[model samples]
Target chain A: MRPYLYIAKVRMLSALAYRFDVLSSIVIQCLAVIASCFFWIAAYGNQQAALGVTRDQMLTYTVMSSTLACLLTMNVENRIAASVQKGSVALDLLKPVNIFGIYLWEDIGSVAIAFLQNAVPLLLIGALFIVAPVPASAAHFLLFILSAAFSYMINWLIAALFGMWSFRIVRIFPLLCMKGHMIRLLSGSVIPLWFFPQWLQTVLSFLPFRYIYQLPLSVYIGILSPRETAAQMGIQFIWILLLGCLFFEIKKGVTRHLLVQGG
Target chain B: MPLIKVNDLVKEYTVIKKGKGLKGALKSLLHKEKEILRAVNHISFSIQHGEIVGYIGPNGAGKSTTVKMLSGILSPTSGEILIDGLSPQKDRKRVVQNLGVVFGQRSQLNWDLRLGESFELLKRIYRIDDRQYQENLAMMDAILEIHKFIHTPVRQLSLGQRMRGDLAAAMLHSPQVLFLDEPTIGLDVDGKQAIRKFVKEINRLKQTTVILTTHDLGDIQELCSRLIIISEGTIVEDGSLSDLIDRIAPYRILHVELYEEAELPIHPLAEKIRQDGTAAVYRFDKKKVTAAQLIEDLSCFCKMKDFRLEEARIEDIIRAAYHKKEKLEGV
Candidate 1:
C-alpha cells in the first residue's frame, strides 16, 4: 500500500515536471468553458422554460460538465500505448507490483493534478463570473463529490480497457479518438441528455459513459432530489463493481500472454 | 547447489505473416498465416555462486529470450528454471526477491524525475528501509560517481550517466543473482571499465552470481571466467575461454625472421606454413612441440633475427563455433 502511494507521489512529481504543458492545457480548458457557456446560453435564447431546466441551471450544468470532463478523461490510453510501443512496460513487470495497480495509482496522480490545475479553476471562474452558482444544499455538494469519485473510477476502467488493446493493435490513435468522441457525445458533455431524442436517450442509458460525467453534473445542478441522488449512487456503484471485475479479468488475460514489442 | 539452474528451457512465439503491397495485404487479411518462432530452444546451463559467466550469441540467437525467462519477464513454453531453489514461473514473487535485472536498451527509471528521486521511488517500491537505502546509495555513488548528477533528470543525463544510474538502481536491493543484458553496450572505454569494476567489486565483496549477455568480447575477456555461446537457439559452446580456444584451434603459429635468406629448416614437430623473403612462419601443435623447444631446434640450424608465437584469436574461434564446424560442433 505504501509502495503504491509512493508511485502516485512519483507520478505527481513527473506530471509537475511539465509545468508548461499543464498550464497550456488549463488555458485551453478555460477557453472551452467560456465557449460552452456561450453556446448553452444562446441555445436557451431568452426562454424561461427549456426542457423544464432554467437557463441558470443549464449554465451550471455546463460549468460542472467542463470540470467533470477534465477530472475524468485523462487519455491514459495514449501514454500506455506509447509505452507499449517503446517496450518500456516490460520494466514495470520486473517489479513485484502489479502493472494495473501502478497504472491506477498513476492515474490518480494525474487526475489529482488535472483537478487542481484545471477543474478547480474552471469551477471557480464559472461560479464567480459565468453564472451565479446555487447548490440545492450542502449535502448535495457532498453527494456530488461521491458521485464524481465513482465517475472517475468508471472513466479509468474504460480507458484501461482501450489501453490494453494496444498490445494487439498496431494503431490505437483512431480507437482512442473514437473513445473520446463517444464519451463526449454520450456523457451529455456536448449537450445535456435531457434534450436528446427519446430513442437516443434510451440507447445512452445502457452505457456507463453518462454516469461518469452527466449524472454527476446533474447531481450538482439539483436536477435530482436526495432520493434520486441516493438511487443513482447505488446504480453508479453497480457499474463500478461490474466494470472493475471486467477490467481485472481483461488485465489478467492480457498479462498472461504479455508480449513486449519494439525494442 | 548452483545459484541458477535451467533444464531444457524453451519459448515459442506465434507471429502473423503479413504480405507486401495492396493485393497481398488484402489477401493476408482474409487468410491469416501464422509462423512459430522458436526464440529459445532446449538450452540448459547452471552457475555457481560468485561466478561471472558471459552469455554470448549472435543476433537473434535467443540470448535475450533466455535472460527474459530467467528474470521472469517472459514465460517459457516448456522447461524448468530454478533460481536459488525456486521456480521462476511458479514462485515469481519469491524468486524476484532474490533477482535483479538490467537491460541495456531500456531503463527502469522514470524519465521525468531526478536521479535521486527515481532511486527514492525504487527504494519505496522495493521496500528498502531507510538505513539500507542510504547505505546502498552511498556505495553506488562511491563506485559510479553518481553524486555529481544525482539531481539531474534522467532524460537530461548523458548515455553513460544514465547507464550508471541504471546499474545503481538494479543493485539497490542487493539480489543474490543479477542478469545483465548488454549492460556495457554503447559506452565509451572508460564507461565500460567503470561497469567492469562495479561488476567485479559486487561479485567479489557480496558473492553475487552474475549472468551477463553481451556482444562485447572485451567484457567477456576482462570480466567473465566462463563463457556460454549459443547459436540457433542451442548451446554451441560452454566452457572456459581458454579451453574453448584450445579445443577449437589447438595449434599456435611461430614466426621467425632469419639474418639472411636461407633454406627453410625442417624439424620433426613443426610444419612450415609460410615463407617469404628471409621470414618463415610455422604452425605447430603445442602438445607436440613447445615454443622454446622449437626455437632451440631452429637456432641450432640457422641464425634467427626475430621470433614470436601467436595463439588462436578468440574472435576466430567464436566465429568457427558459430558456423558449426564439424570438429568443433558439440565440443
Candidate 2:
C-alpha cells in the first residue's frame, strides 16, 4: 500500500514539474469556459423558462458541468494503451505492486491535481463572470463530493476496460474517441439532457454517463430533491461496482496473456 | 540449491504476418495469416549464488525475451523456473521482490522526477528501511558518483548518467538477483568501464547474482567469468571464455612482418590467411603445430623482420559459431 502511494506521490510531483503543460491546460479550459458561456447565453436569448430553469440557472448549469468535466475525464486510457504498445508495461509488471492498483493510485493523483489547477480556477471565474449557483446547503455540497468521487472511479474503470483491449488489438483510438463523443452528448455536458426529446431522455436514464456529468452538477445546484439525490447516488454506486468487477476480469486476462506472449 | 534454475524454458509468440502494398494488405486483412514465432526454445541452465554470468547473443536471439521471463514480466509457454525456490509464474510478487531488472533501451524511472526523487520513490516502492536506504545510497554514490547529478531530472540527464541512475534505482531494494539487459549499450569507454566496475563491486560485496546481457566484448572480458551464448532461441555454447575459444576454435595466428615483399610459405600445418606488401598472416592449429615450429618454417621461406603469436579472441570464436549456425539454417 505504501509503495502504491509512493507511485501516486511521484506522479503528482511529475505533474507539478511539467508546469508548462499545466499552464496550457488551464488556458485551454479558460477559453472553453468563455466560449460556452457566450454560446449558451446567446442561445437562451430572452427565454426565461427554458428547460424548466431560468437563464441564470442555465448559465450556472453550463459552468458547473464544465468545471465538473475537468475533474471527471482523465487520460488514463491513452497513457495505458501507449505503454502497452511501446512494451514499457513490462517494467510495470516487474514491480511488486498490482498493475490495476498502480493505475488507480495514479488516477487519484491526477484528479487531485486537476481539481486544484483546472477546476478551482474555472469555477472561480464562472462565479465572478457568470451567475453560477452556489450549493444549496452543506449537506448537498457533501453529497455532491461523494457523487463526484464515485464518478471518478467509474470513469477510471471504464478507461481501464478499454485499455485492456489494447493487449489484444492493435488500434483502439477510434473506439476511445467514439466513447468520448457519446459521453459528452448523452451525459448532458454538451447540452443538458432535459432539452433532449422525450424518447432520448428515457434512453439516457438507462446509461451511466448521466450519473457522472449530470447528477453531480444537478445535485450541487439543488435541482433534485433529497430523495432523488439519494437515488442517483445509489445508481452511481451500482455503476462503480459493475464497472469495477468488469475491469478486474479484463485485467486478469490481459496480465495472463502478457506473461504468455512476453510483451 | 542454485539461486536461479531454469529447465526446458520456452516462449512462443503468435504474430500476424502482414504483406506489402495495397493488394497484400487487403489480402492479409481478409485471410489474416498468422505465424507462431518461437522466441525462446527449450533452454536449460542453473546459476549458483554470487556468479556474474554473461548472456550474449546477436539481435533477435531471445536474450531480452529470456530476461523478461526470468524476471516474471513474461511467462514461458512451457518450462520450469525457480528463483530461490519460488516460481515467478505462481508467486510473481514474491519472485519480483527478490529480483531487479534493467533494460538499457528503456528506463523505469519517471522522467519528470529528479534523480534523487526517483530513488526516494523507489525506496518507498521497495519498502527499504531508512538505515538500508542510506547505506545503499552512500555505497552507490561512491561507485557511480550519483550525488553529483542527483538533483537533475531524468529527462535532462545524459544517456550515461541515466544508465548509472537506472542501475542505482534497480538496486534500491538490495535485490538478490540483478538482470541487466544490454546495460552498457551506446556508452562511451569511461561509462562502460564505470558500469563494469559497479557490477563487480556489487557482486563482490553483497554476493548479488548478476545475469548480464550485452553486445560489448570488453564487458564480457572484464566482468564475466563464465559465458552463455544463445542463437536462434537455443543455447549453443556455455562455459568460460577460454574453454569456448579452445573448443570452438583451437588455433593460433602467427603474424610475420617481412623486411621485403616475399611469397608466403605454403605448409601442411599452416594456412596463409592474409598478406599485404610487407606483412603476412599464417593461421595454424595449435594442436597440430606449435607457434615456434610455425615461425621456424616461415623463416625458411622469407626473412622475418618481426613475428608475433595471437590467440583466438571471444569475438572470433563467437562469430564462427554464428556463421556455423547460419550455414546450418541455410538462411
Candidate 3:
C-alpha cells in the first residue's frame, strides 16, 4: 500500500511537470469532437434521422466517445515496452513486491491522473460546444458502468500482452502502433460503429475490440436495450477474465528470461 | 542455520551473434545464428550466518549471474536455491524480504524525488514500523552523513552520495542477508574506503551476512575473509583468501639494483622477467628458490646496491588463476 501510494504520487506529479502536453491533449480532443459534432449536425440539418439514430443521439455518441478516447489513452503498452528496452524493468524486479501488482497499480494511478486532469477537462469543453448525452436512465447508467469496467480490462490486457513481447525484441512500439491502429479503426474509436456498413458492423460486434470503444459509445447513445447491454457487458467480462490469465502467464515467462539473461 | 544455500545452480544462455555494419545486419535478418553460453555451470555453496564472503571472478565469469540467482531475481536452470530455506523462484516475494542487494551500475532511488522521499517509499514497500524506521534513519545518517542531501533528488546526488543512498535504501528493511555486487565501483579513493568501512561496520554491528562480488581487488583485500573465484562458469577455487594464495601459485618477486650496469641472473629456480642498466626484475619460486638463497646468489655474483622482496598481491594471484583456468579450458 505504501509503495503504491508513493508511486502514485510520482505518477500524478509527472503529468503536472508538463502542463502544455496535458493542455494540448485536452484542447485538440475537444476541438476535433466539436468539429465532428457540427459535421454530423449539418449532414442531418433537415433530415429526421439516419439509420435509427437521431441527430441529437449521434451528437451525444460523438461527444462521449471522443471524451472516452481521451480518457482511455493509456498507452500502457508503450510505457512497459519502453521500460523493457531501457533496462529499467530490472530495477523493478529486484524489489520485494509483486511485479504485476506494481505495474497494474501504477497503471491505474497514472491513467487515473491522466483522465482526471486531461480527459475530464476536455469532456467539459466538448459539452459547452455540443449536447453530450447524459445516461438515458439509472438502469442504463449502471449498465454503462459495467461495460466501461469490461472495457478497461480489455485494453489493459491487450497492452500488457504486447508489452511482454519485449523479450523477443527491443522495440515493441511500432508493432503496438500498427496493432492499436487496426483495433481503433475497427472498433470505431476514430469513427462511430453506426456509420459502418451493416455487414462490417455485425462483424465488429462479434469482436472483442468493440469492448474498447463501440460498446461504451453505443450504451451512452441509448443504442442498446437493458437486456442487450447486459449481454454485451457479460461478453466483455468473459474476454477480460480469459485474456487476463494469459497475460499473467506470458509475464511470468518473460520475467524469468529477463532475470536469467539480464541486459 | 545457513543463511544462504545453493545446490547445482546452472544458467545456460543463447546469444544471438550479429555481424557489424549494414550488410551484416541484412544478412542476419535472413539467417540468424545463435551461440550457446553456459554462464553459471553446476555448482553449490552455502554461507553460514554472519559470514562476509567475497565472490570474485574475471570478466564474464558468471559473478553477476550467481548473484542474480541468489538474490531471487533469477531462477536457476536445473538446481535449487534456498535463501533462509525457501526457494527464491517459488516464493520470490517472501524470499526477497530476507535479502537485500546493491548493484554498482544501478540505483533504486527515484530520480526526480528527494532522497527522503525515496527512503520513505522503501519504508512503505518493506513495511517497516515507524519507530524502527526512524531509528534506522538516524543511525544511517550518523554513519553515512545522509542528512546533508536527504532533500536532494537522487539525480542531484554525487556518485559517492548516491552510493550511500543506495546502501541505505537496500538496508531500509534490515534484511538478514546482503548481496552487494561491485558496491564500491566507480568511486574515488575516499568513497571506496568509506563504503568499505560502512560495509565492515554493519557486518560487525548488525551481524548482517554479506556476499560481495567485486572486480576491485582492493575491496576484496580489505573486507572479505573468505573468497570464491570462478572462471568460465565453474568455481575454480573456494576457501579463505589467504589459503588459496598460499596453496597454489605462491611466488615472491624480487627487484635488485646493481652498483653498475649488469646482465640478468640465470638460475633454474628463478626467471628474469626484465633487466635494465641498474635494476632487474626476477620472479622467484618461494617453495624451491627461497628469497634468502636468491639474495645470497645475487650478493656473491654482483655488487648489489639494494634489493626488494614483494609478497604476492591478490590481483596477481587472481590473474594467475584466471589464466590457468583459460589454459585448462584451451580457450
Candidate 4:
C-alpha cells in the first residue's frame, strides 16, 4: 500500500514537471467546455424547455458533461502501448508491485493533477458565463460526486482492458482513435442522451458508455431523482465488476504474450 | 547449494512470416504464414552464493532473453529457474524482492524526477528500512559518487552520471542477485572503471551475486571469475576465462630476433611460424613448453638480440569461440 502511494506521488510530481503541457491542456479543455456551452445555447434558442429538460438544466448538462469528459479522461492504454513499444515494460514487470496497480496509481496521479489544474478552473469559468442550475439537494451533489468516482473507475477499467490489446498489437493509434470517437458519440459527452431518439436511448441503456458521462452529469444537474441515481450507481458498480474481471483475463493473456515474445 | 540455478530453460516465439514483394504481402494478408523462433533453447547453468559470471554472446544470441527470465520479467516456456531456492515465475514477488536488474540501453529511473527522488521512490517500492536505506545510499554514494549530481534531473545528467545513477538505483534495495545487461556499454574508460569498481565493492561488501551480460571483454577480464558464452540459443562454452583461452587459443607467440640470419632453433614443442631476416617468431603451447625454457634452448643455437613473448588475447579467444562452428567446418 505504501509503495503504491509512493508510486502515485512520484507520478504526480513527474506530471507537474511539464508545466507548459499541463497549462496548454487546461486551456484546451476550457475552450472545449466553453464551446460546448455556446453550442447548447444556440441549440436551445427561444425555447424554455425541450426533450423534457428545461433550458437551464440543458445548459448545466452541457457544461458539466463536457467538464466531466475532460476530468474523467484516462489514457492508461497510451502509457501501456508506449511502454511496450519502448521495451520498458520489462522494467515495470521487474518491480515487486502489481503491474495493474502501478498503472492505476499512475493514472490516478495524472487525473488528480488534471482535476486541480483543469477541472476547477474550467468549472469556475463555466459558472461565470453559463446559466447553470444548482443541485436539487445537498444529497444530490454528494451523490453526484460519488457517481463521478464510480465513473472514473469504470473509465479506467475500460481503458486498461483496451490497453491490454497493446501487448498483442503494438500499433494501437487507430484503435485508440476509434475508442475516442465511440466515447464521444455514445457516452453522451458531446451530446446528451435526452436528445437521442427513444430507440437509441433503449439501446444505450444496455451499454456502458452512457454511465461514463450522462448518468453522473444528470445527477449533478438535478435531472435524476434520488431513486434513479441509486439504481444507476448500482449499474456503475456492475460495470466495474464486469470490466475488472475482463481486465484480469486480458492481463493473463498479456503476461503469456510477453513471456513468449520477450517484451 | 547454488544461489541461482536454471534448468533446461526454453522460450519460443511465433513470428509472422512476412513476404518480400507487394504481391507476397497481399498473399500473406489472406493466408498468414508463421514461423517458430526458439530464442532460448535447452540451456542450463548454476551460480554459487557470490560469483560474478559474465554471460556473453553475439547479437540475437538470446543473452537478454536469459537475463529477462532470470529477473522474472519473462517466464520460461518450459523449464525451471530457482533464485535462492525460489522460482521467479511461481514466486515472482518474493523473488523480485531479492533481485535487481539493470539494462544499459534502458533506464528504470523516471526521466522527469531528480536522481534522489527516483531513489526515494525505489526505497518505498522495495520497502527498505530507514537505516538500511541510508546505509545503502551512503555506500552507493561513496562508490558511484552519485552525490555530486543527486539533485539533478535524470534527463539532465550526462551518460556517465546517468549510468552511475542507474547503478545506484538498482542497488538501493540491496538485492541479493544483480542482473546487468551490458553494464559497461557506451562508457568512457573512466566511466567503465567506475562501474567496475562499484561492482567489485558491492560484491565484496554485500556478497551480491552478479550475472552480467556484456560484449565488452574488458569487463569480463576485469570482473568476472567465470564466463558463459552462448551462441545461437545455446551455451557454446562455459568455464574460467583462462580455461576458455587455453581451449580456443592454446599457443603463445614468442618474437625472437637473432644476431644474424640463421636457421631458427627447432624444438619438439615449438614451431617457427614466421621468419623475416634475423627476426623469427616461435609459437609454443604454454602447457607443453614454458617460454623461459624455449628461450634458453634458442639462445644456445643463436645469439639473440631481442625476444618478446605475447599471450593469447581475450578478444581473439572470444571471436574464435563465437565462430567455433565455422572453424570446425573449415577444418
Off by over 4 Å in 4: A259-263, B325-331
Model 1: per-residue Cα lDDT over B1-331, one tens digit each? 9888999999999998988999889989899999999988899999998999999989889898888888777788999999989987667667776788889989988899999999998888888889988888888888999999999999999989999999999989888988899999999999999999999988887788999999888898989899999998999989998887778888888999999998887788999987998899998888899999999999998899999888777777888877766334321
Per-residue CA lDDT of model 4 for B1-331, tens digit only, reads: 9999999999887888989899889989899899999999999999999999999989999999999889887878899999999998778788999998888888998999999999999999899999999999999999998999999999999988999999999999999999999988899999999999999999999999999999998899999999999998999988998888777777888999988899885789898787999999888888999999999999988899999988766777788888664221111
Give candidate 1 regions above 4 Å deviation.
Answer: B326-331
DockQ of each: 0.68, 0.57, 0.49, 0.68
Distance (Å) between predicted and true CA of A132, model 2?
3.7
lDDT of each: 0.85, 0.85, 0.80, 0.86
lDDT tens string, model 3, A1-263?
Answer: 77777676766665565688877877777778888888888889898789898888788777777767755666567766766776666667778787766777677777778788766776687667688567777766777767776787788888778877876677677898888788879887767776788999888877778888888878876878778877887888888988988987787678777723342
Model 1, chain A: how large is the TM-score?
A: 0.95
Candidate 2: stretches off by over 4 Å: A259-263, B255-305, B324-331
Which of 1 and 2 is the better model by TM-score? 1
Highest TM-score model number: 4
Query: What would the per-residue lDDT of candidate 2 be over residues A1-263, giving only the tens digit for each residue?
Result: 89888887877888898778999998898789878989988998878767567777777778878888887767678877777778888888888878778887887787788889998989888888877558767988898888888888877777888888777775778988988898888888878888899999998888988987888878877779889988888999999999888877777767768722232
Tens digits of per-residue lDDT for model 3 on B131-215? Answer: 9899888877877889999988788899999999999888878888888989999999999988898888889878999999988
TM-score of each: 0.96, 0.92, 0.88, 0.97
Cα deviation of A163, candidate 1, in Å: 1.5
- Count clashing pairs, candidate 4: 0
- Scored against the true structure, residue B106 in model 4 reaches a CA lDDT of 86
Prediction 3: B-chain TM-score:
0.84
